[model samples]
Target: MLSQLTYLSFLAVFAGIPLSILVMGSVISRRGDHQPVRVQVGGVALMITLALGYTIPWDSYLIARGVWWYGEGVVTTRLWWMPLGEYLFIVAQTVLVSVWTFQYASVADPTVGHSWRDRLLGVVAGVAVGAVGVGLLLGPAETFYLGAILAWAGPVFALQWGVGLRYLLAIRRRIVVLVGVPVVYLSSIDRIAIAQGLWTISPTYSTGLTVGGLPIEEGLFFLVTSLFIVQALVLLRWVIARWG
Candidate 1:
């Protein structure tokens, strides 16, 4: 119960990131300053908003459509004025937004300062992780599961770009982003995958496993995939900084 509260708190902070950033951007833009911090925070907010923008509305639609039944046979029709689930869901929505915000922070390592090679490596790492996620983790692709996989996993990638850019910090970081991003991303997504049990063999390539409705490897896959994205974005920044 306490753990759930903590989780919800994280959600609230993450969900509010965009709003916070927007306010910050407005203030900073007024100052006529283009500080990287402000720009970065703004980018973070925009990315997060763009990323999770779809889920909240869709969830609302589902709730309204009577798609989500309930837990313990209790339908929370209202919590002080708003529907109970809706209220909880608003919190959930914020959390969903927040998770992606912190998750995608810029690579913190000094080594990831700015370099083309490292950034490119991050891209390679992200792609590799994404591929692995589509291949080994999910255990084969069934006609490109983007729409399905993306619904849950997209947020992670939104934030992983920093970590992915952090790829150049070391071979260890590279490997982690390459391998770990997908794992984390996939796991985050797999639980909500709402698929048929663990070992969700995507209709081919054999060998699969599942736990609580998603593949075991998926969580780890998400982690790696998100990191790679961070890495690639870092690289892009390096290029633009050099050329521009």
Candidate 2:
């Protein structure tokens, strides 16, 4: 029998690819919608690249510190102590999210706007989050998992908002509807994976807090990750339209 991680690895790809295809189908099927093919492709590519760049190092550190651990033999391969499934996860999740967000944008709120003040606050908030994440890393916090999640996630989220808040906020409703559906679905899947021992979180590095068997940090991880992708998609639409 395949280990749970192996099972999950297959599931992750299966889920991610079809869902992305579904989103693309939705995008192309919509009447009167103009798809920005080049920009969408480029933006999603960047999102995947950046997502891996961040998650790989962060996850490796967390695993090394016992913040969480993947079950032994769950993966058939490992890269620097992180599972191959994880690397695929970065790509799969981003594709699913990027396609869905842009699809929703085409259907519901198709215009992008700008706001200088939101931009300013976004930069300031990103800086603050970075500062706080560093402090948490250096602080005497009994568990660093929360800090670590927030440190990276917070700044990335804030910076994306800073540059793209106007566009994001314009379609905030679509964002909420689109992003919420997946977060709930994925978080539930994640909860099951954790429960099944696909991965383990160390209580020593966590607050022992959980929601419906999912840790608060895990929940935030999904939320921020979705938001980051959404913002990036919106910003790409805005920039590509403006300058492309």
Candidate 3:
């Protein structure tokens, strides 16, 4: 069962392969609009690095503290409290989201511009999330799952808004659709995985809330992750255009 769970984990990550191929291939087909695939590829690499760098420690802490764990006999290998599939999940999700955002952004053809409105919105958003995150951290220990998630993701969300808020604001609609569609789609997949006993979350450590059998924290995880990848792409596009 453990090996089977490990295989299921592998299957989840492997799903990204065909997803990436399809989205990236579409971008290539419309190269006239999505020219400079290098930018998209470069951005994907960068986000993957950043996502893994951040998520590994965050996830490691959770696993170490028993906030979540794979079902019995479900993990075949471990690297410092994390299953190998987790690392792959970070990369796979980063690539999947980045490529999807890039492909769609190309189609949207948004005019990127920085403005005071953008900065203002960024600061406001950052402060809001940071405040919530801090509040959660200072709250009950049983809320560790929520607190940890917000504590980590809130700052990143705020930072992206502060740095690339305008670019994101410029492409807000696309980002919404890009992030929204996948959040819902992937949330369902996640619910199924949980139901199948691929992994288990501690109800005591969570709000015990379920959306389609997935803990709300788990849904927020995907939501924040998608947002991070999309915003990272926006920031990368700006950097490449400015410095590349």
lDDT by residue (tens digit), candidate 3, 73-184:
6677789989877787777777777767776664433356667778778878877886787788778876778878777887787778877786776677777898997688
lDDT of 2 by residue, 1-244 (tens): 2344463465655566678677768757873257557766787788888888878888887877778777766777777877778777777788888777766665323356557988897778777877777777777554477778778876786778787766776777777887797788778878877877878878877778899989887887888788788777766666766666
> What does the lDDT read for residue 33 in candidate 2?
56
Score candidate 3 by TM-score against the native.
0.86
Error of 2 at 19 (Å): 2.2
TM-scores, each model vs. reference: 0.37, 0.85, 0.86
Which lDDT values do the candidates have, in the order given?
0.41, 0.74, 0.75
lDDT value for candidate 1? 0.41
**Deviation of model 1 at 69, angstroms:** 8.4
Of candidates 2 and 1, the better by lDDT: 2
**Ranking of candidates on TM-score, top first:** 3, 2, 1
- RMSD to the hidden true structure, all candidates: 10.1, 3.0, 2.9
Worst 10-residue stretch by lDDT in candidate 2? 1-10
Q: For residues 1-244, write the lDDT of model 1, one tens digit per residue.
A: 2123322243344335544664566555543232255545554455445434544554455345333233322332453332454454334433333333334333334343535665556556545545644543344343233323433443444334333444444435444544453345345534532331211234332224555645433443344335433444444444444444
- Per lDDT, the best of the predicted structures is 3
Worst 10 residues of 1 by lDDT: 192-201
Error of 3 at 208 (Å): 0.9
In angstroms, the error of model 1 at 194 is 12
The better-scoring model by TM-score among 1 and 2 is: 2
